[model samples]
Target: MRGLIAAAVGALIAGNIAAAAADNSFAVRDVRVFDGDKTIPLATVVVEDGRIAVVRRDAPIPAGLMVIDGHGKTLLPGLIDSHVHVFPGAEADALRFGVTTELDMFDISRDFKTWKAQRTSLGRTGQADTWAAGLGVTVKGGAPLEMLPPGMSVPTLDSAADAQKFVDARVAEGSDYIKLFIETLSEYHDRRTMPTLSRAEVCAVVAAAHADHRLAIVHTQAEWAAREAIECGADAIAHMIPDRVVGTHFIALAKRHHIFFETTDDVWAGASGMDFAQKLARDPRVAPYLSPMQRATLLATEKKVTPRFFPTVLANTRALHAAGVPLLAGTDSPNPATAHGVALHEELQILVRAGFTPQEALHAATALPDAIFHLGRRGRVAKGYRADLLLVDGDPTTNIAATLSINRIWMNGYPVDRTLPKK
Candidate 1:
């Protein structure tokens, strides 16, 4: 969902740092641990060889090892941003704000190879690990093509058979999931009409992805399109529909099918001419970490209330949550008014406003997204999980904004330098 290359450059630009600790191990003593689902009060967490070695209330602190004081702080699993567009340095920016992993919804950059290599190593890279939908499946000249930069092309399908081929090719390309652009929303703030894949084509791609053992995520913004996606058995929906109030029937259908959603509220707020993005950018807690691109992108969004569907977006999110549906916190970042890490924190607050307790909202950003997308061994602070953790000033379990009070962050058990980047 990111914009122009120049704008991306501004966000990705960062101040650099040196290598990891000599042994890549440490311990956080006497901390309140949010182990993704529940809380562990006054625990000692040991990290060794880039994974959690021990988690106990009174774990032995080995002599001669580095120990970070966790007094008055809450430690949580480093965040997993459910949706983003990864440009270079995007991962670093995410890590700067405690997001250790990213679920990239769409890209043609083919950086997943490098991402995998970096993640496999135990060295400190100061970047978030990533899983991407390398090239989304769409009709020829479909949804994103209109949104993409000029001359940038992704493979397209003509029929259901073509959709099948695209699925296989996407799998071969190392896409972590399948993305189907099924957009046909009759109205939008942008007011740009584009072609979308048909129901048969959407079904073909979803079926093939399942056969290949890939999760299929559909991009739809209308109630009808979402209904079709659920019936076609999409693993998830990319964005909440904004055109109208979501119905009980649809909520039941989603639950029956076990469909999770990525809440890209920032994207729709910009679309509906709301100041949600601007207000978040101006947040005193969040503003200091903004890169030049984040500042530019956030402030440059159009300020018109085209179509005015912002209320419906919030209503649907509340309705869905009230029905006990799992919602993942995602900012379609580097999009119009959304930046990478900063936008995700804003989403946590928005979820809280939508009736999610701070703890439940934290789960949406941490455990839920990781499990829903099958990102293994990195979403919790339990023993043997990857040692990607965040230490913040206040207990985020009680106040979601406490996530932004980041005191320290670790990726693969190596301390991350949280200093603002020197663009």
Candidate 2:
């Protein structure tokens, strides 16, 4: 099934190669614009030479340019997924659902250059842009060891010197950022045990990354681990603390340090229910955009409800968000019932359910991630930004689920072909 989807995506890419190479320009007039930060009730946005040219009220339509009448539609900056695991066709699946950028937390292969190039390559069609942390730093026989590919090397760090060396190697490999693993298996499983990096080691890695001018993000599912990561000067927390509700002290500390958080609520929710996946696959608005592999994976199995930690996760996220700590929307994609691209929409809904206003949810998925990651020239509908945008039938700023009603998606001024071939 994966092969079939890959082949179909390849054929679509080949068919669009000529269109992708040509210079693209257009204007979306009379649209309700969500300019990353707020909603502009009525506006016109123009794109030319693959960049936003003008964004204003009642702009004059230029002669000889293609125009899309966006009456009653809302225009938003393309969604950005802050946490994902990239694989073949992942970007294609993401683009189909209006996710134009995906920030990968870890990839066992450590092939950063290839993925980075694919992201920045202009005039490419049918793929979402990507930024990656090549390989995550973990301890010997750590949490991720069980998940690593059969023969992949599992490097361990103990001393501060070892931490520095590990970070240096990742920097040399062109990692966009550094990812540190600090998970304790006991937090998630009853009997399993795993080693974690010491606080000194984590601090050392953070210092090394900062010396190289890179942000270090940490993965932790427990409160103690999260507190340790923050004390160690990690810039972001990749997953929310799931074991219990975080207190005001930790929230204050995170705010003081300006640490961003990715509340991967979809991951935790999916862990207990194949229902989440099935619901997404069955949604009329999202089903049309999913690829064969995605559809098959979502419908493949039904698992009994297990103990869920997401209620506490949501509470912690609300606390951090209310305290002015930055939040990022991310779905730990391709994990269990979570699918790439589509999972992000579910995440936005989850955020709204967790006490975020719909606009706040949109901000978490758009402007916030771009600002936090320093991803330039994207994630906003403004003059001089990259022309990555999504047009939906209703106002998503008020009703978050409207995000899935994608009317059109533009990447670098080119309209993406959203049609899927019949089986």
Candidate 3:
């Protein structure tokens, strides 16, 4: 009986090992794995189906599994561009740049639904995973309504009662979270009217969003407006205002409220150089992202408008970093000066320039954003995590530029064509 039992136990252990090995079918050999946290030199990452199975250094090779020789390469979690507008133009190239997951912070409900369906289909065809908040909630004659192109929905709330109805309509339309734009005093002056939403009304919208278990991300540019939005229980601030110096009080409040800051410092920097049309358009680096047609439109829109308030912006970004607010990577893409996907990498560079270590800046673009979105399956290289990863030629931890030096992107375990090369 003892001999029989011993044989059975040995067989059971063998079965378990086989199952574990079976789980790790997608393996990359001799690659340096930077698991979005620390470096594992000369490691192998085995991903089965669409999930990570194991990250082992010098582990035994499983039989009959596909392996890619990652010689002189580094493997890291695929980047997440937390804020982007993907309606048109270079948005598809985000995958080529190593942006595997993108969060669309604004777009109309109907359009968002269509985009989401298309993204789902593309996923079946092996594309990047895309998610969004359907159309930002704003006042009837608000900023987005004034700036965005035609066909974009801008639901405006006039009073506190109107705010509640607007919130309900957005939730019904499948908005992931509520986006608000609180007007600054200067903006109110330029528009030549009193701001529509009162403090109480804005607060009501925040309350309504919370009741529905959705977060509220506010587009506020001034210190006072930011404070008001925070007081109303906003979950995040979408931009770092360069117009005003943010004090420690605001930082303390932000920390207390657990508010995440999307420091779109790069967009501001790029937009600042728009006044020098010849310099901006003729420059080789900026030309690819900007078109002749778009430059003509920009020259017409704000022809005489020189770049505004740059020093303050740098200071605001610096202060935010010092304050320890959970910084998020975002580029207001498809905007006048910034393009999609490519611009996100520029944001990472700017963050690194503003005193962030390469690791921290990369985290903002990868692991941190996933954590912010409560996306459990995406980011990191652990068992059960999504196989969204980038294979690069050099170690990105040593230099920021190495982050964009992509060899290939594995989206849900399928290779993405970097050059959009012909079949």
What does candidate 3's lDDT look like per residue over 1-423, in tens digits?
999999999999999766544442468898987776667788888877767888888765668666788888889888888777655433455666677777777775345565557444324223455677777776677756666667655557877777767888888887777887776445223555435467887798898888888888888766788888888889988887755677888888988988888877765665566333344445454445344333443233222323554456677777777788888888766565555555666778778777888788888888888787875567787777878888888887768767656776777766665544332
Question: What does the lDDT read for residue 322 in candidate 2?
Answer: 84
- In angstroms, what RMSD does candidate 2 have relative to the true structure? 6.4
Between candidates 1 and 3, the one scoring higher on TM-score is: 1
- All models, RMSD in angstroms: 8.3, 6.4, 9.9
**What are the lDDT figures for the candidates, one per model?**
0.84, 0.85, 0.70
Candidate 3 or 1, higher lDDT: 1
The count of backbone overlaps in candidate 2 is: 0
Clashing pairs in 3: 107-135, 140-156
Stretches of candidate 1 off by over 4 Å are: 1-23, 189-192, 420-423
**Which whole-number lDDT from 0 to 100 does residue 304 have in model 2?**
46
Residue pairs of candidate 2 with colliding backbone atoms: none
User: Where does candidate 2 stray beyond 4 Å?
Assistant: 1-23, 189-191, 296-305, 421-423
The 10 consecutive residues of candidate 3 with the worst lDDT sum are: 297-306
